[model samples]
Each structure stands twice: as C-alpha cells, then as structure tokens.
Target: MDRINYQHLYYFWMVAKQGSVTAACEILHLAQPTVSGQLAVFEQAVGAKLLRREGRKLVLTDTGRAVFHYAEEIFALGREMAHMLKGRTTERGVRLNIGVSDAMPKLIAYRLMAPVLKMSEPAQIHCVEDKTERLLTEIGLHSIDMMLSDVPATPAAGTRIFNHFLGESVVAVFAAPTLAARYRDDFPRCLNGAPFLLPTTNTALRRSLDQWFDSQQISPVIQAEVEDSALLKTFGAAGAGLFFSPYAVSSEIQRQYGTQMMGLAEGVFERFYAITAQRRLKHPLVAAILENAQQGLFDLLDKPAAAD
Candidate 1:
C-alpha cells in the first residue's frame, strides 16, 4: 500500500462533513476533478471504501465515519500548533480571544473593533458573544482572554483592567401612541396594569426592574418574557407590548423607525467593564487590546453627534 497522503485525507474529511463534493471543493478552493481524483487515490491507499452515493447525497461508509473522527482531531491540533507558533514569532502578535455578553450593543461592539483591525494586524482576534454569566465563566476558565460586560452579580475572580461608566440611561416602559392616548393623563399609571415585555427573571437588569416595581407596588402584566434584550426591543418596536429598556435603545430604535421614548422617572443605568486574568495583564498584546477597548468606548459612545 502507498503512503496515505495527508492532503487527500484533509479533503476527505471536509467532503464527509459537508456531504457534497461540490461543497468540499468550494471550501478547499480546488477544482472538482482534482478533489475527486484525490479522494479516489485516498480510498485506494486506505484499502477500503469511504463514501457511497445515496440518492442525490454522499453518505460516509462505516469506515469513513471512523476515519473522519480522527481526521478532525488531527486537523484541530495542527491549527492550534500553527496559531501558537505565529504568536511566538511576533512581539505584539497574539491570538486574543474575547467573550462578550449579548447585552452589549452590536453596533458598539463592531465600532470598537474596527479601529483595532485597521491600525495593526499584529494580533488575530476572535470574539464570542454569550450571556454575562457564561462569558465571565469563559474568562475565568482561560478559554477566553478577556471580557466586556455589565458587572456580574458577584465579582469575577480577575483583575479589573478598566471600568468605564456608560452613564445613566433611562429605562422606560414604552407603549404605542394609541395606548398612551387611551390612558391619557394617567398613562404612567397605566403601565402598572399594561402587559410588559421583559428580560428573563435571572438577569441583573430584570432583577433591578423587579425591585423598582416592587417598591412602587406596581405589578406589570408581563405578556412575553425573553432572555435576549435585542428581541425585546424588536417586540417593543413592533408594538407587541410595552417594554422596559435603556435610553440607548430608545434612541437607536427612534432613529431607525418612528417611535417614542417614555420617561421611566425611575432613573436606572447599566455600567460596563473590561476584565482580564491577573497574570495576563502583563502580556503585551493583551495590554494593547485593553487600552484600545477603553479608548474606543469613549470615541464610539461619548462623542458628539457631529463626531458620530
């Protein structure tokens, strides 16, 4: 038997995963004929059939499934090895992995990253967005290098790299103009009985909102409960129900679609922070990323309208 070609094995793994020769060809950026020939050669060298046509699709044979699992492990290790080597070769170069809470605004996140990618390509950045709790956990476990989030309920065991105040943005219960007119001079009172669209019960924002409502003895008629703040904003924008959200969203939605922001009078705000592992703060690339994040926040959020 001829020595198995690693490149052909790589192609076979991709084809098996994608379940189509065309898809594998596109992903590997090779001509269809070249990929097909490589697969045939690979099968001959391996001494077993790997894939068979089933109807219009390619199905992996029993042996193919076995090989694919090993191939995945091999390729994953190779990629990690390459990343580590690249990190060691450049002074300011590192692969920085950041995790962010979904509660953070997407526009702000994108804007914050634009300058970093533009100025220097020293570090490769991978950003993952999840809930605050999960993101903090990732940062703590060393799966992620840093996090930008609303402060967690308990302090995450890490050095606080920097804290930035986004300032007090109003959280208002907003309803349709028709509903507002129906309640008229007593609209604020109507919010007590009106159906509310709220975040999940466990979130810090939800907890704060619950405390405020409890103090006022106002029980909101919660029609829909969501974990995603963006979705809540969508439902609110569609006039599905009254929603409690930050002024940033109110301003954001009003700018895009015609809407109104009802004053909460409650005076609540969300604050954010950037955190990194204590030991990692001294890493050159990590320090650079943190500094950039702090400066970017001011430029993106606090700038004058003309500057924006």
Candidate 2:
C-alpha cells in the first residue's frame, strides 16, 4: 500500500537472474547484506513472498516467478531507452522483420537474405511467409518492415508502398531421381504429359506458366495444384511430380531437396520484388539486401530488379 521503489525492484531482478545474493551483489557492486535487504523490502512493498532457498540454490516462489517475468521486460525496456537516448542500439540483437510471399521459393528467399547474416552486424530476422496480398497488408500496417514477393504490388495495393524489383530468374524445373532421368534429355518435349506439380492459379508464376504452356502447346499432366512453394518442392523431391523454382537457386534446390534438375523453364520468368512503405528505401537491413541483390546474388539467373 506504498509507492514501489525501483532500486529495490532492480536489486530483486538482479538477484533473481543471478540466483544468489552474493553474485547479484558482485554485479551490482553492493554488499551482500545490502542486496538481500533490498530484495526483502521489494517483496514487502509488493505484498508478496518472492524468494526461497532450496538446498544450496535460491529459487523464486510461484508469485515471484511471475513478477520476475514482468521485471525482466521492465529492465530490458529501460536499457533500450537508455541505448536509444545515447544513439546506440541495445546489446540485444537488432531485429529485421521480413515478410515473404508463399509464391516465392524458400531457397530463393534464403539466398537473398544470406548477405544480411554475413554482415558485421547481422540482424535477427523474423521471416514470415504468406500470400502477397496478406504480406502487403502487413507492410502497410507497419507490422512487417519489408516484403519479398514474386509479384510486384499493383497500383491498387496502395500509393504509400513502393516496389523495388530485386531481380528475375527463369523457372527451373526439378524432379526426383525417378523422373529426372526420364526427362533429362528431351526437356521441353518430355515436359509434355510429364507429371507436373503446378502452383495455384492465384500466383503470378502460375499465370505466367499458363501463358507459356499455351504458347508452347505443351500440356503437362497436372498432378497437384499446390499453394505452398516449399511443399511443392517436398512433393517434387518425394517423386510425386516435377516442381519449378527460380533458376538462380537451381543448385540449392537440388542440394537441399536431394532432387535433380530437369532443366530450365526457358520462357517462364520468376521475378522478385521488395515491397516497402517507404518510396525512398532507408532501413539499413533493407539497403543491404537490395545492394547485395544488385551486386550479384542473382547474376547467373537474369536481369536486376531495377531494370524492370
């Protein structure tokens, strides 16, 4: 029923983290008696029993555990504030939230992001995979910092969000060993009546492939209409059917899935775009990704994102 003391709360937090008053005292540069007394006062002030000793170890009571959880967040935010005021990031890792469209292959996404992890100050990236529409909504809501999408955001997606073309790659068809040998030699011709795992009509890649299939007059025996890119790869790897991914990661796809590359989908192109709320890209992580993509991440595949 009195004002809580932050100093007492801090001491208790330190003791809870360190597991012993002596260790907490060493870190806090306070006497053992002073740290113990502060923790006792903190419990009294909060009207709850906080700590107890079990054997040689100090442990928190049930209520103490709950309170300590909140205390951890409180002190972490305090440190964050101090760091922000000093124009330096906290000791905790920096975060980069990236939204990826389900239409984009996970392999392509991973390769595009490798440079960020290799940087001197690599960030902790939270990668979310969903449809382009949903990811665009998250970017607009500021829930997602940026998005990697196969389809560029349409004019109706919103004027505030701008699309930076990352790069483009022709689609590479891959199949499990059983199907690989059968289709290796006569590619475009063997593709006719081939067991193909196609993307759903909702994806831009599917739409383009449909146009190409029609033009080439090659009708694959559609075995499955998959929505998830990774699932498509898994199915393809399991000998269910042939699947297509960006040619840029042909080797990666073959390596990870233990699948064999059949051949490139010559005329079918898969382009990547980074959709953002900022017209002028500014986030350092985002800048690093774009810079790396331009430098040569997709060099073997095809044209750069900015070329259109």
Candidate 3:
C-alpha cells in the first residue's frame, strides 16, 4: 500500500472544514505557507486538486469533495483507533459513538447518556439522532458502536442486548387544542374525515401503528405523511393534524407547546429495544452504556403515569 502521511490528510480535512488556507492556518496555528504546501502535497498524493479559488473564496472542487468524504471517515476511524490504544486495559474510559432514534426524544435514550458523562474517566461521546432504519444501517456499517430504538425480533446484524418495555404508555391520537375541541370527546369516535399524522412507511413504529389502525378498521384522514418521527412530533406540536405517538416520547414537546394528548378508542404502545454487535457488547464502554440505559428505563417505568 502507498504510504500517506496522516498529517497531510489532517491538513486537508482542516482546509475543507475551514474553507480557506488562511482560516485553516488560524485554526491549526501553522504558517499559511506551510498549510498551503501540505495541502498541495496531499492533493498531489491523491491525484486530485481538492480545492480551488473562487473569487477570493476557497471552494472544494468535485474531486476535493469526494476526497474529503473519504478523508473524514479515515480521520474519524483514526481518532477511534487512538482512543482504543490509549484506553486502559481495565476500561477506565472510552469514546463511544452512539446512534439513537429521534422518535422518543425525551425518553430513556436521551436520559441514559447521563451515566456515561458521570464516569470518572475522560470519556468522549458522540450521539447521532436518526430514525430506526438509518440508525440500524449505521450500526451495520460499523459507523456507530450501538443504537437505541424501537426493536422487534431483530434489526440489521445486531444482537438484542436489552429486551424490555420502555413503559406501558398509550399512543395518543391528538391535535391542537382547537381541533380536539372540535371533536369534543367524539374524536376518532368516528373516522369523520379528521386529518391524521401518519408515519412514513417501512419504519418499525409505522408498521406497528398501521397494524393497529388496520385492526380497528379505521382509515384516518391523513392530512400529511412524514418520514421522520421527530418531524412528525414537530408537526403534531404545531397542530398541523392529529398524529399517533407514544405519549412518553412526545412528552417534552407536548410540555413545551401545550399540546394535548387525547384518548383514542384504543391505545397503541411501542416496544423499544437496544441493539449492538455481539462482539462489541463485550467492550467495557458498550457495557457501561447498556447498563445506564437499562437502569434509566427501569426508573422511567417506575414513575407514576402522567395525565393525558
């Protein structure tokens, strides 16, 4: 394999991030000439001009953009490698890249990270908030160490580390207070053509929700459909239309926007699970995160039910 200087790649990454040789120099605290020279060498080694001058501004060329994409991955993996090498054998600290589904923004996944931060060692954490399918894809690609999201049987190539209910909560079919009052306890009482916030297809949450709705034989007036669970919550909070989500997941948004969680003819609750590579589960850092999540869920379940 051709030898590439890691520092050269680092300099190139800085240039791409900062967008100018002078800006890169300021951030890297190196001479402008030195930064430029290193970038030149890096581009030469990669056989591409990574940046171009565009009327007093530095712009990444097409080749530059492509190179930077791979460069970012290389550097990210390099950082993780350094952390692994420096981490104590007894596992005093570690850097963890965790992927979490944004569906339940204020639930166990968000709160579970607390214990990791409280650890004695200098642990670095990177949390990526994404949907279930994307998060699972990241885990499969090894971009993340583990993920927390709604689980059913299996997801990607990960093992089921924790199989427990987040809470016995109901999925509320609600709208903004104004709209709910329009139905006046008779809401969802009939599929009277009120718009519903339907989840995008193919998601575990969506499949479960659709199943429940189908069983009830109700074809809701889906005013809008969204792919992102977080976006769905936002739309619901804004009173765009009535949507279904576990109350616990949207509790934070509801509290902020004063949205009401209304009763449905029947309740739909989602089951969440945490998944990780079987080998990764042995890592001390992975273990720590799982432990924190398990405890957090237990605590959440023990709390008294919130009034709808």
Which one wins on lDDT?
A: 2
Residue 205 CA displacement from its true place in model 1, Å:
0.9
In angstroms, the error of model 1 at 36 is 26
Q: Once superposed on the true structure, which residue ranges of model 2 sit more than 4 Å away at CA?
A: 1-91, 300-308
**TM-score result, candidate 1:** 0.57
| TM-score, cand. 2 | 0.69
TM-score ranking, best first: 2, 3, 1
> Residue 272 lDDT in model 2?
89
Model 1 alpha-carbon drift over 4 Å, by segment: 1-96, 105-125, 153-168, 175-187, 282-308
Cand. 3 Cα-lDDT: 0.68
Q: How high is the lDDT of residue 51 in model 1?
A: 98
Q: Per-prediction TM-score, please?
A: 0.57, 0.69, 0.63
For model 2, residues 160-195, the per-residue Cα lDDT tens digits are 999888888888788999899987876677788889
Clashing pairs for predicted structure model 2, backbone only: 165-305
lDDT of each: 0.67, 0.83, 0.68
